[model samples]
Target: MATLDLTQENFESTVLENDFVIVDFWAPWCGPCRAFAPIYDQVSENHLDIIFAKVNTEAEQAIAGSFQIRSIPTLMVFREKVIIYSQPGSLPASALEDLIVKVRELDMAQVHKEIAEEQAGHA
Candidate 1:
């Protein structure tokens, strides 16, 4: 799948509707973001099951602010409507591929249980 451009209007709906999503928060002026673009696109082509999306921070300030994106080229992975992983930095193709494998292998039932327990504790 090709990477989809995410905006403030569609970000929430996309996350809610997609089972697995990878979001790349980036800015046009960021050198690292430019370098990572092709790598992200390449990986997206191989993962037809995942929704690979990008948020141009310069254009989508609200979306970036909501996610507390402190740096460009931040990669966030969401599964079952829960954010599973979020990190700042550009990754090599091999590392990105490995991350996708790990995300796919995650036991979401267990993850949800953990989240529920954590929320309960907080409450």
Candidate 2:
């Protein structure tokens, strides 16, 4: 439907609900972040099933730091609460749409399970 503003309060529940998510880590003061807002919104409008979230780095500093977001407009793709893809800077509208499509096609369940097992082994 639309992009959700993710804060520390809701990040855990919303992002870790065993679903796919595309989080845009941004700050209001960043020029590239502003430029990417509409493109990100366009992605949400087109991909109804995907959860599009926005996190204001200025406000969610802890969350941003946890993700090691060094850039203003970083896009992180997650599946089952595990990060799959992360990149800095802004993307074009068409590229954004392609990313959504790619994410939808991935075998995320298997991936997440594998990741979980790997982490468990390490732990």
lDDT per residue, candidate 2, 1-23, as tens digits?
A: 98999998999898778487899
**Highest lDDT: which candidate?**
1
Cα deviation at 55, candidate 1, in Å, is: 0.3
Instruction: Give the candidate number with the greatest TM-score.
Output: 1
Looking at model 1, report the run of 10 residues with the lowest lDDT sum: 1-10
Error of 1 at 104 (Å): 0.7
Clashing pairs in 2: none
- What are the per-residue Cα lDDT tens digits for candidate 1 across 47-102? 99999999999999999998999988999999999999999999999999999999
Stretches of candidate 2 exceeding 4 Å from the true structure: 120-123
Candidate RMSDs in Å, in order, are: 0.7, 1.6
Q: What TM-score do all the candidates reach, one by one?
A: 0.98, 0.89
